[model samples]
Target: MADQHRPGTLGHYVPYLLGRHLRAGAWPPEIGKRAILVLLGLLAVVYGLGFGHMLGNHDLSATLRANFLLGLYGTVFTSTLLVDFVPSYRPVQRLLPDHFPVSGRRSAELAFLLDLISLRRLLLGVFLAALACVPGQQRVALLGVALLLGATALSFGLRWLLTWGRGRRHPLVAAYAAVLALAGAWLTLAATKSLTGPLAAGLPWLVALLPLGLLAGQVAGLGPQFLNRNLVRPALDTAESQWLARLSPEWKAYLRKTWPALSMGLAFKVFLLVASSVMQAKHGSDSSRSIFYLVFLPVISFTYANNNLYGYLYSLTLNELQRLGLTSRLLVLYLRLAVPVLLLDCLLSAVLLVALFPASTWPLLGLLPLSAGVFLALGLWGSLSKAKPVYKNLDLMNMRNNASTLMNILTLATAATLYFMPWWWVRAGLAVSIMLTAVVPVRRLLSNHGPQRRQLHHRLQSM
Candidate 1:
């Protein structure tokens, strides 16, 4: 039995991969060491200032302590998602042999490790561990551990979501819902400090252990729950609705390739709606921090996709560009593909505003439009200036698809304050102003038929 199990154990594969990575000097496959060094340096400086400011606070209040705890959780969770999702730090993955004798749980686990081990990821792990040193914070350590475990379990569900097994009845779907609910409850309880009796003492332990148990069951016990149907197709007609069929072929094709990100964004919007409503109900409009939460509504969808517009469609758009150069046709196609999402984004933002910040509803009517313009312009700029090579695998964990990391930062930063001066005329004027600014990127793209898209798409299929 020991001999039989050895082949399926991670110990065998991890040592091999670790040896290979160390031999190869730990350089990430698609990116260079210099770039990673630059980014890590910048991040170190920023993190140093930010954590120093927070740590400087010696006498923490209950609310401030609660806020810090929540912020720590959000930071750990978001950073894990962001860092893992982007095409970074996976070196030995490409070195896997074709006939390697890996199977079942072992195969899945090996695939994960192949992607996980890299110099950048290890550095990030160190950065995350430093959160424990912050003064007056005790739970940050356990919470971080529990969060990493929960996040791993959540990835299985998220991965299944990008595949065919995404309906309500699917086991992964049910698991996803349960995990999300549990996460919400965990934060809410942490904030309210109301985990009662024995439950309160064991809650952190449960959060840490339960996810590990769930992941073990899924990986080792659940046989053949993988979703691998319809990996690639020219048109997504199988899943198309009447509304989608009405679209032109070019539009439909573009939407077909990019539908998953849009769907993911829509999924986030649903959660935000529920979470925002709950927050508003508990705190009401009286909370000074409500607007800060509500102000991010326009950006939720952009985080998934819009901010990386060109990279998201590089595979398709490259062919079009070769035929047309960087002409008005390219700009028109970009606008056409973007308009519907922008409209939908506006509608969603409007709904959230009305639900939570009802008074600001009319004033912030231009919020989504302004956000759309700003990001579209910024995304276009990044496409020209800071694009990256990405894959088209529709992996649940991989959404950016060679997106611009700079634009990602700018997108969030811009949205954080987009609705800052949330007065009717002020927002409208800003919206118009940004829309006019878009012409600059349009001229930039048109004036230069840059070959970045084509070069980037060399590794991609025509889809």
Candidate 2:
């Protein structure tokens, strides 16, 4: 009776509430629908271009095809998790029923269905299914369907337990997923005897189906209270969590100033490190490991760039740092913070390299920090040249994205060439020339602090 009497009960109110949320702003449903359509259209174009590239190169290895399919499946599954459960950086948080006066059970069910059966997911499924109809990949299509169902269900249950119910569990859940993925990859490698083989073919299905079983296990334990508890809400704010209390004062300050950007970068960095190490372990031979390192030179270089510059800019953390005065001190602060992490990465990578390469080739490990430094210098150069802070506007943002991508490609091409170059002196000359070229930009960026410093000094004095 109370449910029926309630003015905004889930059944009667949710649709209206959703309508209000959608129509609240200038953006109309047609615009939203058109945006979604355009996005799907772009996905189609991307798939076509990717397929054409593969065909053009005549490089359609089964491993490449399998990995591409798996990536698509993972993308669809990740989009679901991101839309519904993962509370980090959600753009649509304002539109959720949590903001309204809806009752719990109905809201939970509706949210669950909406998250599970989203239009984006459906479109992606249709796209992938059509791709599977390609000459030799019907099984891949079936596997994709199976993965979508299984990963979505599994993420659903995981979100209920790790994200929906309690304190700061989502981060732990992410860590758990990373570890689980690595373990699974290790198991697959062990079973297959090679990274690419028949085992890889069946692994995707198994990976997808395993989650369904995991989801089933949680339901009995969760009981009826699950419905009452499952309504999607904002992730618990860990801004003031004590987890970082034990960090050194400098580290704490760095994290406080950087906030989510630094945290995200660190997570990504860790994942890259793990992935690189795993690949190194798989390729036991010295030549293979050397080649792997050379091939991924740009990747490792860009990992640092992505974590630092990209993350800071995207999260608007760089703007925050600009308030501290863009003087030599600020530059030093960044380098000091970077050095510890860079050293750690270098050490881990060196350990992997040592296991695979001769001691003489060990000097090449210096390239990690060297290239990272070069990119950081380039980032500073770009920032200073604008006379404003980094990542300021749409046009600049587009320029930055394109420039960063082009830089990465050029860096990769150069690294690959250097790897094949026989003359040691030539490699040394190139390295020296690159470093020397970087020095001018780094120096210019450090000195170009005009009015910003005076304002920043006053702000600091006031603080």
How high is the CA lDDT of each candidate model?
0.56, 0.50
On lDDT, the candidate that comes out on top is 1
Model 2 poorest ten-residue lDDT run: 389-398
Clash count list over all predictions: 0, 0
Runs of candidate 1 exceeding 4 Å displacement = 1-13, 19-58, 70-124, 133-140, 153-184, 216-237, 240-247, 260-331, 366-463
Q: What is the TM-score of each candidate against the true structure?
A: 0.62, 0.58
Per-residue lDDT over 1-463 for candidate 1, one digit per residue giving the tens place of the 0 to 100 score: 6674454344566688767764443444546655655577567546644663575576757577556656766655544544444332211122334344444446555545544444444444545555555554435555665666556555543453343232335576666667666766866786677766786556656655565566666656532333223211124446567778788966766665566666666666666666665666677744434444343455544555555555566655677666755667667766777777777867876776676655744564556666767767766666545544344534343564445567777777666666565565765675577667667767755675456445434423333
Clashing pairs in 2: none
Off by over 4 Å in 2: 1-103, 114-127, 135-139, 164-243, 246-326, 356-363, 369-373, 386-422, 438-463
